[model samples]
Target: MHKRVHYAFTVKRNQKNLHHQLATLPRAKASVKFSDRTDTHGRLETRVVQAPAVSDLGVDFPHATQVAKIIRHRTQRKNGKRSRETVYAITDLTSRQASPEHIAKIARSQWTIQNRLHFVRPTAFAEDASKVRTGHGPDNMAALRSFAVNQLRATGRTNIAAGLRAMSYEPFRRPLDLLCLT
Candidate 1:
C-alpha cells in the first residue's frame, strides 16, 4: 500500500461484521459480473464474480473502494462429488482500475501464491517447528528461507523438498554452483 500498489483480498467469515456486510450487498446493482469455468485436478470448477456498484458501505477499512462476491461451484469428475462456496472480497481499486475479470483473476492467483510460496516454506524448511519466537528472529529466518526457496526456483527446482535433499547430497558443491560461488 505504501508503494502506491493496489490490492484486492478476500474477506473470510472470521471477519463476521465485514463478511455479513458484503454478503448481503444487493447483487441487482452489480456494476460488473464475470463467470469462468476450468478443469483442474480432475475437477470441473466454475467461478462467478460480481462487483456491485461502488458505494459507501459501513465497513471499517481504509482505502476500500469496491466489494465483490465470488461464488464457486466445483464438481469432481472421478467421484461425482460436488461443492459450492461463496466468498466476499474488498479492493482498494475502483471499478475503472479493476474490472470484474481482473478481480476474479486476482482471487484465483492467491491459490497459486499459497502453493508456490507458503506451502513450500513449512514443508521444505520445517518453519513451523522452529523455536524462533523472539521479535526479529522469526522475521529474519523467514526472509532467509524465502531467499533459499527463490534460489532453488531460479535453478528450475520445482519440488523444493527434493531440491533441498539433492543439494545436501552434494554438500557445498551444488549449492555453491547455484550461488555462483564456485
Candidate 2:
C-alpha cells in the first residue's frame, strides 16, 4: 500500500496568484477560529488564527483543503512596545483531519523546524559565506551541510556549533569515519 503525506505551507507574496486568491477571501465571519496567549522573556504575545474550509473558495493550489490567516500581536511588558503581523497559509489536511487550532499549532511549529535545521546552516557552518555559486555546487554543498548537522545530531549533540568545534579538534580522519567511507 502507498502512503500519503500531508503538509501545510505559508503563502508568500512571491506566489502572486495563490496569494491573491487567499487574500480576496472575506475578512468577516470566518468558519472557524482559535486564539491563545503566552508570556515569555518580558513579552506578552497573543495569536489569533482564523480558518475556513476552501472547497469552494477557489484556491488554485492542488489538493488545498483549507486556508487560514494567522494574526499575532506582541507587546514587550517592560517597555510597552507593541507589534503585529498577519500571515496566510494553506494545508492539505481536511477540517475533519485537523482542526483550526491544530492547524495553528502546525503552522507555528514550522519555525522551530527551520531554526533547528536550516537556520544552523548559515550560523554554524557559515553556509552563506560559501564560494560555491555555480549550478550543482551550491546544492551539493547544502546537502553536505545538512548531512554534517544530522551526523552531529545523531551523535547526541544538541549544540551544533559546539559540536562542530569539537569535531574540528579531532584528527582529520575522525570526521571522515563518521561518513562511513572506509
Candidate 3:
C-alpha cells in the first residue's frame, strides 16, 4: 500500500506565477480549495486555501518542516509572481526513504498532472463540451484522447491540442501510425 500522511501550509496572495511551482512537488495529490482575497491596492489576491497531504518527506516532522522551509524560501524568492510573501503548507504521504528533494519532485509532478494533463487537455481540445457526460463514455473517450496525446508527445509534438488537431487533419500514414494500437 502507498504510505500517506498530511501536513498544512499557507500560500500567499498575488503569486499567480507560482501556481505551477507548487503543483510539481512530490507526493501531492490535490488541494482542497484555493481562494482569492482583496489586497491593499484593491487588486485580487489569490491563495492556496488547502492542499493534499505531501508524503515524500521523511517520516518525522523535522523532515516535513524542512520541506516547508524550502517551499517558503523558494516561493518567496522565485522569479515569478512577485508578492508580499505568502506561505503554503503541504503534507506528504510517502515512503520511508523519501528525501526532501524527492518530496519536491512529487509536488511538482502533481501540478504537472493537474495543469498539463487535465486542465490543458480539456481547454485545448474542448473535451468538456463533447456532451458525453454519462457513465463511462466521458471517461473512455478521455482515455483515448490521452492516448493520442501521449503518442504525439512521444513523437516530439509538445503542444497537446495542436498535435491532436494535426493528427485529425493529416492523411494516411503518420497520424494513423501515431494513433494505431499495435
Off by over 4 Å in 3: 1-95, 171-174, 180-182
How big is the RMSD of model 3? 11.4
For model 2 the TM-score comes to 0.90
Q: Between prediction 1 and prediction 3, which has the larger lDDT?
A: 1
Show where candidate 2 strays beyond 4 Å. 13-17, 180-182
TM per prediction: 0.85, 0.90, 0.47
lDDT of each: 0.87, 0.86, 0.52
Q: Write the per-residue lDDT of candidate 3 for residues 74-171, one digit (tens) a residue.
A: 22223345544434444433333444444445444565677767886688778868988889998899998777667777888878877767766755
Worst 10 residues of 1 by lDDT: 52-61
Per-residue lDDT value at 75 in model 2: 100
State each model's C-alpha RMSD to the native: 2.6, 1.9, 11.4
What tens-digit string does per-residue lDDT give for candidate 2 at 50-71? 8888877777889998888888
Residue 163 error for model 2, in Å?
Answer: 0.9
Q: Rank the candidates by TM-score, best first.
A: 2, 1, 3
